[model samples]
Target: MTCFPVVCEVESVMLEMQDPKTGVKSQPQRLVITTIPHAITGEDIVAWLTNCYSIEAEEAWALGTMLVAFGYIYPLQDHKRLVIKPDASLYRFQTPYFWPAQQWPVEDTDYAIYLAKRNIRKKGTLELYEQVQYNSLHKWMNHKWDFIVMQAKEQYRAGKERKKPDRVVFDCQERAYWVVHRPPPGTVSAMDYGLERMVDPNTEELLFSCLFSLFSSLVKYSVTYNKHDPFLAPCLPSNPWVTDDVTYWLLNMANVEIPTKMRVERWTFSFGELLSDPRGRDDFRLFLKKEFSGENLAFWEACEDLKWGTAATMNDKAQQVYKTFLTRGAPRWINIDGKTMEVTVKGLKHPHRYVLDAAQTHIFMLMKKDSFGRYLKSPVFKDTQKRAILTTVENAQSKMGIIILKRRPSISPIIVRQLEQEERARMATSGPVDITQVMSKLSNKGKEVPPSKK
Candidate 1:
């Protein structure tokens, strides 16, 4: 007779009994079971049952089911776990075959299109969304959105929590934007590079409005004249830097003081530095307004804001932006040059997300060359500069009080002479003097001398 020792701990015991009416009785059998250790796998337990217990295949299977039900064993989810010996063919960077199947499972790609569409719709990528929705999945279809979905799905299937996008789809309404190509892994799309996304929506809207007002006037000027001037300068008087509810609302949202610290010293900063500080940029906009060329700065800033705004609001913002800044006579127009303006205006008819690139670039260059230098020399800016320096001096003085030596109350002649005598006496004696004898002599002399009463 052969004996097999079961290597398992008993988890639970149950008694079998008979049903009264049907008279069906079950045997009260003692079932001795084994529990799998945490470190051991289901296959290991099965092998243990076969080798140690020497059980028949059927009995081993029966025990296997019970072990699995008791949470004592589990099947490996990673297909690679089955491969005892991994070879070069087992793992490849492009594609690997852990299973016997010659082809790796083509991850269900049907949702790729739908997910891309939904993402485009969510992000306001109208051209891409429409392309994916109406057209076949081709090279032109925005692969970046599809890639994001694939990565997200892969992460989820791998037991990682799904990731959400932290960036906005579009930061500016005026600029037409589209994803041209799929970005490499670990890099942002080309459209997103060097663009601001996180901005106050109200500020974005106000900037759009300002640009619209400027461009609308330009378009009106263009239609009346047959020969549109390429280098038309703004001749209008400067508009006061308007502070309506929008400005206050945005400030409150940011929890920052108005015309922030940077705004006060706008004249001293370069255009690049001004771009980083919203308040400084705003002050520069006021200078541009004074020059009657505020539209250039407004359009550029609006584009930046929209570029960095949440990705979801891009489409509608883009449309409104196009109508306002690019379209002829649209409200709050950015007065771009004729050739560029015409190109932008035509592009607006079939606006893709990046259609405003030429115009934005033109305006950026225009502002950098023209308004920036003049801004430094502008009377308003110079005045502000003077006030800034004065304010700085005053603030410093207040923070750190000035110390002045009051003319030492002129020392009395007698006290000065006594102090000199004391200094000489101290210098002459190296050892300690007997003060008791000196004091007695002085008192005796004082008593002998007649006292002069004043």
Candidate 2:
């Protein structure tokens, strides 16, 4: 079951990242970042993490996503440290492609040998996850219990003091994580481009991240650990996603099955497409004959374990022409996020995240951020919620207090009319009449005074 606390935590972390605060304990967030050409550019993700994590963008690489990507991948992790592969007893990979030992290294065969040796040395077996900080076992269950204790303390204190919590919690037992950018309070929908809208919190990370803003006010957080336990709190039926802990909350996603026969034939592409152009071809038959119009090994070799459902159509002029030209030349096309583009790898939903190196299987990596999760320029700015707060310092243009006119001032037309009537009554009678008023009965005081004899 997907933990609501975990989902909320991930969402909160996302919120904290947009506007970070310092000097106080707020919340910690785990970001799940994904992109094309995964290893080539960590700039966008790194810059983001450094901003929120309050570390130098360069230093941000020391933690979380980047850490996992660089240190935990097969060959590097395998070579640097002797470790056993996670076994079948506790938590197991559904497919051979996902096995820890198989996908972790740059050099596959050597790493596998190393893993085997380590496992045999440790327990007369080749299991790796048993010796790590977070093994392939039910570590998250214990972690979940610990979280409940902490949350219970916080929840009880919150109830007593009527305190608004600055943090939330959650766990992602399922593989997919979310980027929930909650809008400011009461904003349940996307309007005025507000970033803090509350999302379904139950969507694929792709769907969630697309809808949520890259900037926002609220905090979203996630706990990404691989463990499921029976001790979790009973999840409410109305929200099967787990506002609390839910071990039974089941979600079927990322099943990791191989590609179907039709998908294999239709959705794949070859390197020939990347090397060719379509405009010169006069005839379809001629187009097939011109080049080495066979399956290109360079491109096909890049796609190792990816599998997808179906093929998508090409739309743009360049894409359409390239699509036809490449298809004739032994290439195929695939759709990603609704855009059909030619790919070197065929039959996958997101091939951009896959590198040519077959050993690096984990694609999602997020930037790092600070306790409050702001991605500000200076680490000092992490202390404040709003940017204008920085102005309160010496030589700063910011005014500390918001100048509000005392509630409702006496400046309304209705109030002005009342004051004018009161003034006229106090003045009593007018001494003379002007041309505008002609002759006023109250003004002719000299002729009046029939008097009251008391």
Best by lDDT: 1
User: Which 10 successive residues of model 2 have the least lDDT summed?
Assistant: 171-180
lDDT of each model, Cα atoms only?
A: 0.44, 0.28
lDDT of 1 by residue, 81-131 (tens): 222111111111101121111222323243344344344445744344444
- The 10-residue segment of model 1 with minimum total lDDT is 166-175
* Candidate whose TM-score is highest: 1
Candidate 2 C-alpha lDDT tens digits along 95-128? 2233222322233232233333334334545333
Off by over 4 Å in 1: 1-269, 342-353, 389-454
Q: How many clashes show up per model?
A: 30, 47
The C-alpha TM-scores of every prediction are 0.30, 0.16
